[model samples]
Target: MISPRAPRADRRPVVRSHHGRSFTDDYEWLRDKSSPDVVAHLEAENEWTAHETSHLAPLADAIFDEIKSRTLETDLSVPVRKGDHWYFTRTVEGSSYGVFCRAPVASPDDWVPPAVDPAQTLPGEEVLLDANVEAEGHDFFSLGTFDVSPDGRSLLWGVDTEGDERYTLRIVDLASRAVSDVDVIPNTAAGAMFSPDGAFVFYCTVDDAWRPDTVWRHAVGSSSGADVTVFTEPDDRFWVGVGRTRSRKYIVVEVGSKITSEVHLLDAADPMGEFAVVWPRVEGVEYDVEHVVLAGEDRLLITHNDGAENFEVVDVAAADPRGLRDVVVPASTDTRIDGVDAFAGHVVVSYRRDALTRVGILPLSGGIAAGGVLRVGEIVGYGALTELEFDEPLFDVGVSSNPEWTQPTLRLGFTSFVTPSTVLSVDVATRETTVLKRMPVLGGYRSEDYAQARDWATAADGTRVPISLVWKPGAVDESAPAPTLLYGYGSYEASMDPSFSIARLSLLDRGILFAIAHVRGGGELGRHWYDDGKTLTKRNTFTDFVAVGEHLVASGRSRPDGLVAEGRSAGGLLVGAAVNLAPDLFAGVLAGVPFVDALTSILDPELPLTVIEWDEWGDPLHDPAVYDYMSSYSPYENVRSDVGYPPILAVTSLNDTRVLYVEPAKWVAKLREVGAPALLKIEMQAGHGGVSGRYDAWRERAFEYAWVIDTATRGARDDLESSAPVAPTLDA
Candidate 1:
């Protein structure tokens, strides 16, 4: 591989004034993505990235092959019973996408899912949507909405071919197997669903700021132009979404912002009727509503954080949401009550406790009949909550895919760092759990060979941050540290839970330990953990990450010279800021679509999703204090020329609406000006998630892992280059 000179971005300085502060931005011109020069520069960056890392092509290919070989190429997901059909998805060996499929239910009493074989189709199997067929000519394809009508006669599905998130929805008649061309709706948001009777399809559309603001109801056979606007949110900070209740009784319109939420419900039978507000909007108070029946009386179970930072559930009359209230699940400081799903005789509560995701079932004393009336003997109050337990010390478990209103069992998904994804069904009546399916890993994989544990790091402010560690036993330890990858994403209250990945196994096999820095701003230790990390205290997210990295080194678990920090999206922002705060802490950094230029993006209210982000990151545009605070730690704004930095690889997508591609491009440009070894890889035909296909995603991961392995190992060999361990291959 021949070395190529890095692409130099021509600087044309632009002066901007904000809150009495003047800042000169040299790479601001790159933000005009429509300009031909910008395109040429991005292309040049891509070429430079390709040539600079050309030596790792074989390693990347080997990793890709290892991932593919370890995965079950031909597989079918566990069947989820919905309506009269058992719905599932099948992936063929050679296909890049899944084929949506369904088969008739065995009987009305058949609670167990039937066996499915990937090699052969089940009897009476119907292919609802073949994504491979729809994605034939397009470079990118994303299936957003796929909801079958209650009667199984109509299918309302949405597709995004450009990866920009604007989907085109189409309804197809299952009886005739013909797509209704007249019902095609374009420029819509991500989700859509059919009315209970299949008479109309309810969906949402985005406003100019890329926020879903309007909900529309379109008749089954009517043109999109004839669609009626059901509701529109006037507040730009709030995003509106439409969904159906589990009981299929009402269509719900959920409108929410970063700090508050308000729900509206309309009887599904009344498609053209107005939606009534369940609870009016109250700033600083967030709540979600779930409909349930208690002793034959209609009730609305509301989960709210009004007075409880960790949230609590209250049951109220459906007719009068706030009239009569009964505490169902009281808020606890140690636990974060996320959501609740109601059924005929049971309710599933999803929450986070001990920094792990969990699910608990609360059984109701009464059951529903065929006509949706309670048939069992009337009881007093709700039964005791039964939390589902897992054997793994660190695992993620939650209720999933139990759509039926009268399901006797609750479907759940469980996974850990060493455990493959497992689907389970727990009988609500008996509390008995059954494993329906476990994702297959083709290579010789053993859970006992790997170890996962929890560690804590003390931050400068005396706050303890949790870390999840995974490594092969007996391979690397305290005495002699090996190459390590530390990953983190601490924003939007999103938790980085324990989950299994086949591609990660390649790195683990190569004696590289993987760990997660559960820093602040994430919803790992409850709401307060997230609250203390955002807004004015956003710097904690970065400092917490640095503390975790230092802990790894101080504990001798990771070599100081072999630690690579990786983050994506907001996590990208995390690593970017952490590097600026402690440039000598990491050997390399991998930031994917990072919001590095935070102050610049947040200062402009017109940018996509900027106004809505004011809640998470304070309004720098309006507040002078916020401008100074953001400028103090903003990655691109804080980069210093005097400090020597580790090599960095910033990956971004051209069509990413969430974080514009110019962000990483500009950040890399600034890093390069400081003589930092920085490279940018821009996906020209992708979005924030990168390429759509499974194979393409695998290739992308392989490329990134190869770079991290090479960089970490090369950095590990400081004085004695030949003494460093060679990255193990499949044949090694």
Candidate 2:
């Protein structure tokens, strides 16, 4: 493995013009000295370079080659079945293309090909989708959940190119073995359900700003048919999107930005018509709506967070447009509900209490005053709900930790770091799950010795910010220093949880400590936590992350010289600010696909993602105070040559649309010119995500961890030598 290049020992620290001044004073002086026009010109040039390099056609091809070479030994995709037979997909070598239903895992631990004949078992053998599978190409492909129609005549799959947020809907005619590409829409297709009559398909679309736009109905066999917009925003200030119910009679629409929301109900059959606002926005409250199901005509079971105490499920009948009465599940103040799934006469409600989440079942006929709740099982993590068949005897529930469901008999498949993926059958009534086939695990690894730790740090403002650490046991010492890597993405109410990982294990086993700072501007601690770290309060997130680092050092878990910070996209903003505020705290910084040019990024509302992000970062142009605050800490605008700074490795993709590759490119150029030790690496074949294939991803991570370890270890070695005590030895 290639180690990071160390700084020269003879390179004495340069004494600049400003010395002995506070960081604030140094910042002001640096800003006054740099010409604004020069900064703008550099930014423009960087943007041009990003655009030109991104259009190079060979980039994606090269990336695909890298992905294939690394992941070829492993079976990355698994075969799944909705009907009698099985189907699978896999990418070919030296190509960015994949073939479907070519390989099938007959049983667990069976590495050799099955004795069964392939011609009889395989369905529509190996079809080509994308000929050129470059990560940066416009036609890059992604494999989503397969939705087979009730009669098994057609199958619907979603494809996204370069994580564009928008997806192209495709349909495969099972009978003819032909594929047809549908209209492109903004929102990703989470669930594609065919109408009972099979005349149209219902899917959701999000706007360019990343807000849910409307649920659309597309007629089959028509290229230019009128698209019925089922859900739409009630006002320009708020965004609206709809979710499907099991019965297909009620469509739930949620409206609001980050701080507030209202749940509305509309007849699924006639969704284009005006909807009856079910839950009105409550003042001074921030909440979310989910698990909306239709119990009967004009009656619905709705789960909502009113910001009072916790989320609760209310059984309400839409008798009056403005009034709704609780029926089975009453509103509660202490217990929080996560999800609700209605089947037969029982409603399965998922709730969280005392940091533990579980599912409970309750019968609908029982009144709210007497309905009994029966605890089912502990929820290891949030799982997706799939409708097996319309009005079938049983429906399938996809959950982690249930391995039996991966078998061919169960017909459902799931993927994780340790688990390749397996199909399974689940009995809803008995809650019995069986594995069909275990997808082969790739790479030489196991997930047994890794662990996750949740801790808190007291911020400068006396607020407690939650931080999650994941690593192998004995990776770090409380009394000795070690290479510590801290990661954070504190923006947009995005929660960074302690999830399973295989690639991360590569770092942990190598004696590196990886941690995630769950600071404000995230929904980890609920609404209040997110509210405290967004807009003008965004600075709180930076301070909170710094406090976590300080806690780690003060507690003897790690030293400042052993620390390296990493963040991406919006999190990139956090890394830039944290480094500027306390350069001495980190030995190396990795800002990958970062948005360092915050002020300029927000200035152009016409950009693909700026308008929606305004709700999170605040509109600096509209508010002069916001502009002043943002300008004060904006990474590109805050660079100073008078102050010493840590070495940085800035990584970016030429085709990233969300953060834009130009942001990091411009920041790196500015920092380098200003005498900061920074290196820029542009992945010619990737987009926002540095790499696509599993093996390629692991290699990228390896490079990152190696850089961090070398920097931190080298710093420790230097410190030890400088502080060594003088000793006298007898001559021999």
Highest-scoring model, lDDT: 1
Question: Which 10 consecutive positions of candidate 1 have the poorest summed lDDT?
Answer: 369-378
C-alpha root-mean-square deviation, each candidate: 4.7, 9.6
Model 2 over residues 458-484: C-alpha lDDT tens digits?
999898877766666666554565678
Top candidate when judged by TM-score against the true structure: 1
What does candidate 1's lDDT look like per residue over 617-732, in tens digits?
99999999999999999899999898998999999999999999999999999999999999999999989899999999999999999999998787566647677678999997
Task: Give lDDT: candidate 2, residue 565.
Answer: 90
Q: Write down the TM-score of every candidate.
A: 0.96, 0.71
Model 2: ten consecutive residues of lowest lDDT: 24-33
